[model samples]
Target: MRLAFNNFISIYQGLSREIWVLSVVSLINRIGAMVIPFLSIYLADAKGFTLAEIGWVMSSFGVGSLIGSWLGGKLTDKFGFYPIIIFSLFTSGIGLILLKELDTFYEICGGFFLVTLFTDILRPPIFVAIRQYSSEKNRTKSITLIRLAINLGFSAGPATGGLLIATWGYTSLFWVDGVSCILALLIFVLAIQPKKKIVEENDDSLEENKKSQSPYRDFPYLLFILSMVFFGVIFMQYFSTVPLFYKEVHELNEAVIGLLLSSNGFVIFLLEMPLIHWVEKQKKYSTMQIMMSSIVLVLLSYILLIVGHDLWVLFIGMMLLTLGEMLMFPLSNAEAMSRASGKYQGDYMALYTIAFSISHLVGHNLGMQSVNIFGYNYTWTFMIAGLLLCIVLLQLFQFSKKREELSQTAK
Candidate 1:
């Protein structure tokens, strides 16, 4: 136990103060992130929307996210990350607060789109910030640290949000979520001093320019992004269809569902860093290899659901899914950062963020519709198939990357 504690401490030793502050800001913002997890349920239970209508509403949120990601990337590159971050936090907060007032389906759709537009704008800039703030040696660990904070908040948020919904009503979730975003904005502005400009090393600039002359032109990177979209589509069901599955198939209530969701966050909070640390220490697995393995775990997770109906089966499935998430996300972030040109970091990160945005636009709607039309078993089977396709894409990417590396070495 003493040795285990020391190892845990060691992984966190060298991250920057800025990284820590960013993690805190993420934690604050995400702690209030109660609404999105339960949005489908809220729409159905509160507004009397059918599954199809809820899918459309969620799709609208995705549409906003897709546009916001593109806009945020462009804006971050032009104006820098600081102002964009501030704008996103403030505007998204206000949007969330105002969101509670809308009643009609169209109004809620429009409102959610606008709010998510601003909310998602926060992603690219934050990735840029993480790149700027961290050293290469500790970059992945830094990303993990930020994820740790987010997961920690998720651990608390859903559980609390469930209680709030049970006792006070769904409207309370919006107020809390909006207030948290603003509070995170305050903390960020006060704690993080503006970053000073650094003169780029010639090698760094040359390498960045070579790799990212144009992200649009990079075939391999684009392929990698496609794989990420698949991953996101499969992974995001936990937030969308999985809850409804619990409620509909298992007859679980709001509080119980929240606790189950929170379990993902709690498991990640406790185990992800150590797992990451161990993986990094091995120094043998490439990023793509790790991602492929993670996808397999996620695939297995869905398979468990297809095979069983008990509460224990659900818990085990959640555990497998959470483990896959822990392995996939931080490494994916690092891979994206590595591919980004220092000169156009925002643009690159934005593209990366957009992959998930695309998933959001497609994943939630697809998951819900699949569940509604085909039922849970078919839906889970479809997700498993998606994961299999993702693995193939990753393998292709690995081969392409290896060929490129060998060619570069020969030169």
Candidate 2:
């Protein structure tokens, strides 16, 4: 036991300081942001908003994300990841704090929009650093750890919020989010004081480090971004539609609902690192196909949830969602980074993050309008159609595998 423990410590010790810093930075950043899952409930229960108003308010963050993603990616390409991350974290803190004070619907929604925008705007830069800090040896592993931290934060944040809001009220929830974010920002500034600025490193002809010389040279990277964003609508449904279903069908209370929804995170925390490491050790192309397959399976689970709302059925569906997420996040990230030049790791990662960011916006905007017109059950139908559409896109991309292989010479 001690020998295994010591070896694990040794492996961790050998990771680059930048890698560790980025990992911890991701962990802290996610922990700070995790307070949001219950924001809809908080507004509905404590703020006295109607369902229609709450739906629009629920989407403020997505609206901000839509505007931020492309701009944020461009900023990372122009200035650097460090500046963007530091600025976004602090702004997220301020936004959360202000969310506590707003009373009117417009004021609250407007504040939430900026909060979501500023907070998520940092995603491109954060992901840029993550891909930058990986090696072939640990590329997928490192990102998986980062994803694990996110899920871990997800596991705790809303469950904790449920308890806190149940006793202390909702404004206090944003205050807690604000304080934690401020602390995260402080940690990022202190722990990751980058010794030098971001410039295209001259030396990276390494196996996984071939990078784009300029953002304009990133067309394939941009294609991968389109693929990622296309599927994001399916993923976003877990946050928006699934929660609504739990409330409407199960009639579950805040804490119980939080616990059920959070079980996915629990599954992720226990199993993801080993699973990612194992999957990446396989042939890379096949590995991604498997990950993509998992996503299809996850989408199918939503179909199941849409059909059945019983507790056990929901448990099975949630389990599928968690497992599929454990595979999807890291592998997709690594694959996206793999296609780019060494110098444009940040640029490539930013595009990938842009896909996710835009998905939130597109999904929610569609979701809000769809719910008003067709009702909530068909929201899952839209999600299913989006997932199936992406599956078709995957098929289209798979046929180009030979082209991808032929282009590997570019590295």
Candidate whose lDDT is highest: 1
lDDT of 1: 0.87
Count: clashes, candidate 2: 6
Per-residue lDDT tens digits for candidate 1, residues 256-308, read: 89788888877888889888888887768777888889999999889888786
Error of 2 at 376 (Å): 8.2
The candidate that achieves the highest TM-score relative to the unseen native structure = 1
lDDT of each: 0.87, 0.71
- Candidate 2: worst 10 consecutive residues by lDDT? 200-209
Clash counts per candidate, in order, are 0, 6
Q: Which digits, one per residue and each the tens of the lDDT, describe model 2 over residues 1-411?
A: 999677544444435577776666666666666457777777777789999998788677667776676666777767778888888888888888887778899998899888877887787787777656656678777777777777777666766777876898776777888887788778778887654644343443433434435545544444456667877767877777667767877787778777777687777776787676567557755865786687788887878877885788888888888777787778787777665454454566666776777777677566757877888778778777777777666665655654655676574
